[model samples]
Target: MNKPVILCVDDEVMILDCLKRQLKTEFRNTYVYELAENADEAMILIEELEKNKSEILVIISDWLMPGIKGDEFLIGVHQKFPDIIKILLTGQADEKAIRRANTQANMYCHLCKPWSATELIETIKSGLKTISKS
Candidate 1:
């Protein structure tokens, strides 16, 4: 079977880099990480992954971004691929975004900014475990 892929979206390069390193260290060769700065690029990557027969297993997106908000981005993904696990990370997520994510996207979880590497890894692992069973 194909190994699962992880799609991460963030406007900041540092967060994306940290996530890549941590996920690589924790999951090792089990995942292929794809990073994008905005929703449009993320969608393009999703299409490419789909063509490669490796749909993304999870998405970790920042709640506050330049263009589309994290909730909006996840909602878009959920519209096409409902099974993909969605996680939102932000320092200042508002109530509107959270409510929208809950009602529309069915967001799996939200992590505060400056999330510990260990916690991030554990969250991803737990999410993957759930995905594995289903």
Candidate 2:
């Protein structure tokens, strides 16, 4: 069986690298990690994964991107893949955007930039627990 996937999207390559390293260290072989630079690319990956019968268990996305804001991107993702857990990561997102994401995307959590690795892992763990239950 294909391993469940954790997809992270951020315009900044450095942030994506950091997230990948942290998630890899914590999750190891338990989940597959995928990275995309923007929402458009992420959507392509999501489609491909679905076509391959791979379950995308979670998405961690940055709020500030070139074309699509994180909230909008996540909302679109939720509309199509409602079961995938959505997480927002941002340093500059306004309250309204965050609230909208919570309401529209069923967002699991919002983590700020310069986030603690421990906290990020804990959040993912909590999300994973909820996923397991459902």
Candidate 3:
């Protein structure tokens, strides 16, 4: 099997770059990280990973994007790949959005914008632990 993978989605290029840097620095050998600018690309990556027999252990997505809200994207992912841990990282998602995601997407957690790198790493580690056990 391929190495564990983490898929991160955001419309902003800067955020994706930051996440890639942090993940690479913190868990250099533990994960193969992938990034997408939108949900469509993310879905394509997911399909490719599935075909390649690669386990997508975690997915972190933004809530307020140009199109296809994070909740909607996550719900789609949950329907097709429920085993992937879903996390929301957004600054503007309301409580109702979060509730909807929790119900439909089975969201693992929500981390607000301006999140500390240490906290993100901890969450990633916790998610990996859950996947490893499964």
Candidate 4:
């Protein structure tokens, strides 16, 4: 059986690397972690995972990117796959953007950049709890 996926998108390579490392340390074999540098690439990865019959359980995305912003990207993802938990991990997103994500994307949580490992893991755990209840 294909393991559920946790996708993270960010423009900065270092940020993506850090997220991947932290998630891998915490989650290990629990979920397949996928990283994308932009929204377009993330969409492609999502489609491919779906094609392979993989369930995407969570998505953690940065708010600023070259093409699609995080709020818009999560909203798009929600439109296609409403059950996938969305989390915005950004350093500079405004209130309007975060609000939009909460209402439109059904975002589970918002974690600012420089987030602690405990905070990120706790948020993911809470999100997984919601998914389990649903």
> How far does residue 102 in candidate 3 sit from its true spot (Å)?
0.9
Candidate 2 residue-wise lDDT, 1-67, digit = tens: 9999999999999999999999999989999999999999999999999999999999999999999
Flag regions of model 2 displaced more than 4 Å: none
Error of 1 at 34 (Å): 0.8
Show pairs that collide, candidate 4.
none
Record all residue pairs in model 3 with backbone atoms less than 3 Å apart, i.e. clashing: none
Q: Which lDDT tens digits does candidate 3 get at residues 1-118?
A: 5998999999999999999999999989888999999999999999999999999989999998877999999999999999899999999999999999999999999999989899
Ranking of candidates on lDDT, top first: 4, 2, 3, 1
Error of 2 at 55 (Å): 0.3
Error at 55, model 4, angstroms: 0.4
Residues forming the 10-long window of minimal summed lDDT in candidate 3? 123-132
- Candidate with more favorable, higher lDDT: 1 or 2: 2
Q: Which ten residues in a row are the worst by lDDT in model 1?
A: 119-128
Q: How well does each candidate superpose onto the true structure, as a TM-score?
A: 0.94, 0.98, 0.95, 0.98
Task: Tell me model 1's lDDT, rounded to 2 decimals.
Answer: 0.89
